[model samples]
Target: MNLISKLILGGLITASLHANAMIIRHDVSDGKYIQQAADYPAIFPLKDDGKTKNCVGTLLTPQWAITAAHCTILLEPDSQLEIAGNKAKVHSIHLPPEYGYMKAIKNEQGKIIDIEDKVKDASFDIALLRLSHPLKGVQTFPLLEQKVNVNQTIEVMGWGDFGNGLEGVSRKERVNDRQLRVAHNKIDAINGNYLIFNFDAPDSKNALPLEGINGPGDSGSPALIKLPNGYFVAGISSGGDYPGVQTHKREGKYGWQEYYININAMTAWIAETMALSITKN
Candidate 1:
């Protein structure tokens, strides 16, 4: 089966086997900014054929979407890029040569064999999706002019897989925690081209808290910075591991999330790309 089907099936299998279940029901506000984000959040479904694989994106510009390099591999050049406020036909996909990697092989004798070819890096796990047309949504979030200081609180939002499905079977009835959950943590040391968040969960037994969050569907959700004027798109939620009772590193350590591709780190790249687009047009 395809990737999305596999994911759905896996969720089902896990739910059937595990008796302890967790459900996510987050409160989403109808306030101005929250409404805007809820209505036009940058996140988009990455589709292959007719299946929804995963969500990956950022609203860098009204006409441009930023996402990881790995996500681009599944995309066709002409795939439709849809957001809350607008839809655009992808005109082009640009990826850096060093963004992707491959593994080496071994012979039956256990000797080292040929190594796979190096794929593109997705430009430091980053990419730009140029839309065939512009969007008419509210002004795009600002770009960080300087590198965001470590420990600055940032907001993240997404509609991803949450809780065991045994609690509810209807897909549309699943919880929508669209509220912008805020997490305050220092920057764990950067890894290659990604930024990491030191998300400390509570010491209590209940592992699933509404505010203390991160999960499967949150990948590629924008890490936003609230500035004097407004919020700026700062980083992308990559992935993280939650230590269960058996896997807890310490008695009190909570789950941690590591973000990849600091938008500020790619400020020059963003400026140059937009400038070039503007100039060319």
Candidate 2:
């Protein structure tokens, strides 16, 4: 892939790079999540290295990008999410109004003890970014106007690692092996504020053979819907649950439930934020 030529087709459905990092792995080790890369300029890869956090971001317009709120923080005025051999300097960030952060309370052993208190509103995990420069050439995706109907097929892409198994791996391990991968699944449920997609594994006899599902480091991946008119951004990869009851456990049947920030629910916020970005410049 000639990197720069990686055009975001219509709305970033196809990958400019044939082979992207695997979004998720179902089988044990060496499992392949996605077969190819989603050759789209907006398909950003995520990497959270504590010192600096990384997450996927989609170019909605020349001057604006969208991503997950928890993917990163509002930097101290002058930093950017470096991605795709380029950097989109952060001009401003707009998070959901109801969103609030809870500091992680860690014990003497350094283990986070207050899981519940640190929980934020997962419903409005979406955030919009005003970039210092416009991503040239690639087609920017528009937010979906209508409500997402059930059974609607949606495409998701990210650079998540595969094969965390039931004992899902850590962000550091995933970042080491992450690749830009793409997969598709139908909307299984709607939570008013989210688009719930069920990503089944290849081993699941009765479920859809969706190759991959969102995993750690895929927080800001775009949930794209192919409308009759064109492709649109319907959801942002807010979070997901894997198979088995054990939380954060990797593997088992795909049975991954992915939650995306309902784009329609934040329509006004998106516009208001983008407009504000323009005013800033």
Candidate 3:
């Protein structure tokens, strides 16, 4: 796990409670994203080798995709993700330009000693990936026009981890890692730069009692808000405060306090980047 808000659920394979953990699909979305349940071919699963790393992305257009800035920074930049079983090469990676990759200091054992303690820029994690080839027939989502409000119910999704001790163990036998899952989260805070929410269950009596949470393998996943138009991308998974089983297991906070890069705040950058002729996947 690259400790600066573990991107949760990317292909970094097994993360140490601090990196890309997937959505904890209790009722499912921290545990699911924009569309509830695993809807194939729409929300493309960005995957690598089953052993290495993976991230989810939304196709804004056949030629472009939206994901976290950390996707380019944390994971291998030269590596390609499998989309629809075809190679989606990164032609260009566009961060805010002001943002730089802030890496965690790890120990000799490769465990993250601390999180992103020195990063000053909050507008650092959202990014756009210009694809090598255009995807066809996949539905693209719009960005939420207004800022999300506190207490708003948002649908979240990821292809990250699930099951056991909050560990990045596999659900569905871990064989279907690319299987997209669903879960829900509520907006708890709205700062100008970030959107935050917790994964603890809103109702204890509800079925799927497992609190919906996000963890390794889910980096770059989208947080969606439904409006009259349709489901819109509101936030991109960025850094987060996670209590790995070694520490937070007994803390009673089942869901991590996930802080996502506010997509609405960066729409200008996204639009500007998309229009640019730059390419790098």
Candidate 4:
């Protein structure tokens, strides 16, 4: 099926299934180790009212943030899109170089015209957040031009609530808690515009089903893969599916994860944008 259909079906499957084990709450007394990764400094919580809404972003540059455009636009109403940090502000938004308007075929039926001219490159599914002020004490992670290989292990950290959906509480104690959660996974597939990863379920050795990993709150969180020298942003947490276990399937049969818009694919766009921003400033 298409990306949209996969997302909708995935959501339905996740909602109906409750056979998965509840995530255990570990001790909060110890320092959050997940928050210590290089990527965590740039990961910020995106909030709507006083509640922890979604993951915001870190300032890769004074003007740019690496995030999924689908999560930033489709999931967030225009008015509610605000950055959360020591200081929060919103400025202009930028998409990649090829992010101009495009048409989409709806199944075998008619075409869906530009629903919002603002979102043209949903296929790439990546967006850059421009902040009103330069983020203090934040550093951009290096971008990799080469493709990451399958079976290569990577670490992902995010403020995504540990439980199930929006109503689930965060794994951390405080809403703003910079506490990070680290999970390991390997690359499963490399599509033209996305990358798939296979990770184990919470406390389970078996791999999660297709399109299941970090849930909704992890929408824009970066997947960090280790390199010989350091780490690179491999993928963004896009979406997942969690169907219940059945006799026909194994115990961990229903956990899978799919991430759209791998950062390496947009290296040129990222370099170009930074260069332009530097010149303008």
Return the top candidate by TM-score. 2
Lowest summed-lDDT stretch of 10 residues in model 4?
A: 16-25
The TM-scores, one per candidate, come to 0.62, 0.71, 0.70, 0.62
lDDT of each: 0.50, 0.58, 0.58, 0.49
lDDT of 4 by residue, 1-281 (tens): 44433452333233211111112113222233244434455555554434343544544654466676544433322323333334645555566655553222243553232233343444565666666666565556555557777776666655423443213332222234434566555677787766775444445554422113454455566777667886667776554444232212111122444464577777777687767766786
Clash totals in order: 8, 19, 56, 11
Cα error, candidate 4, residue 50 (Å):
3.9
Cα lDDT of model 3 by residue, 89-206, tens digit: 7766667866655454567986545444333464567778777778665567767778678877776665534442234343223423444556666777887678877766545443
Q: Is candidate 1 or candidate 3 better by TM-score?
A: 3
Q: Candidate 2 overall Cα lDDT vs. reference?
A: 0.58
Which has the higher lDDT value, candidate number 1 or candidate number 4?
1
Q: Please report, as a residue range, the 10-residue window in candidate 1 with the lowest summed lDDT.
A: 15-24
